[model samples]
Target: MPQTLKTLGPKAAADLDGDLMSDAGGFSIDQLMELAGLSVSQAVYNVHPPSAGNNGGDGLVAARHLYFYGYTPVVYYPKPTKKPIYDGLVKQLNNLHIRFDNETPFDKLAGESDLIVDALFGFSFQPPVREPFDQAIAVMEKGVKPVLAVDTPSSWHVEDGPQNEGLGSKYMPDYLISLTAAKPNVGHFKGKKHFIGGRFLGEDVAKKYNLNIPEYKGLDQIVEVPVDVKVEKL
Candidate 1:
């Protein structure tokens, strides 16, 4: 239950019910965001491990352009309730020394980016994205640089399984980092085979990655790729 609901008594909760407790099944949006962010982080570490002396056997970590497209901006959110959420995430990205942009111009973003991280639409998204997200899609489409989508690529339908639609906004990331669990949508994803991984970091890896939260730490590590996971593809 949401913190707001938990505070209310049964009758009070019932009075304001429906939307407050809409039947979206189990997971909350906040949990999903955390899952998505941490999953991407793990994937980044796997694909681009730090140098031997740095973290894991990770090589020298390079700063790359990471794009965060969803409703929330990395460093800030217009809504007061959402500020801390985005801020915490932005701090993490900054701690990792990543360069990121949110809803910037397509041409300018394309020219500047080496790697793009798609943190936009997820399993919760229904259909065509509205104004800002659509605009974000346009910019992403302007370039063919490598991408690592946070959950599923924007506009990719989770309900339909992971099949490539090949539409203008039907993005297929080079890597589709699933959050807590793998979703069927990825198999149908269009890019090179999606590499399935999660934030289920082992305790030692968590310590290595500087993740200390009790609930957030100790997730099962999924990949065995070298610490320095980046490479030039053929």
Candidate 2:
């Protein structure tokens, strides 16, 4: 029998926010970030188990997860002084004794990576990409390595998806690992694979938001989302 797929519009997807970072429940941001990072690491390992290169917000956390699982990961980021977030991320990396290089250029790092994690931006990023990140994203987009985007693809509009349709192929990710819930921008995801992680949302919250998300059967903390399916009401 043919499987009946499920789909959610961008708006509905956006409304489904279960990220532990959000005040949706009692979980701390750090706790949620850890879970989110672990999910991403496992997804990448499942498909492409090799040394990785990561950039952006969740990249550092993801990198740490990879290291814990005995994978080699090279993280690229602006100096901690450039972004306040990097300050804590760097400390965490140092504390865990994970390998990273914030000074090397993206082009040079791109060559070393077997897979790239586009954690350069989250669901909150607005377009135009700005400065160093813009250049870095361009380099990664042009690279031959497959990319797994964390949350949303870098440089893509959160609500509208990729702004430049012409460059869609260039910037599109091979895989997307959405945390908590799928973001609206994921409706624009051109990836071959999409997975939902951060399965900690309570039933009440899910109902209040009308998330309409499916259950993660068995011991799965992450589940694949089929494309072009009919919407199923939760």
Please give each candidate's TM-score. 0.51, 0.79
lDDT of candidate 2 over 165-189, digit per residue (tens): 4333367778888776666666666
**Local lDDT at 182 for model 1:** 37
The lDDT of each candidate is 0.42, 0.67
Give lDDT: candidate 1, residue 107. 45
Off by over 4 Å in 1: 1-36, 48-83, 90-103, 161-170, 199-220, 224-234
- Best model number under TM-score: 2
Q: For candidate 1, what is the TM-score?
A: 0.51
For all predictions, the C-alpha RMSD in Å is 13.2, 4.2
Q: How many residue pairs clash in each candidate?
A: 16, 2
Consecutive 10-residue window with the lowest summed lDDT within model 1: 53-62
lDDT of 2: 0.67
After the best TM-score superposition of candidate 2, give how far the Cα of residue 175 lies from its true spot, in angstroms.
0.4
> Hey, what RMSD does candidate 1 come out at?
13.2
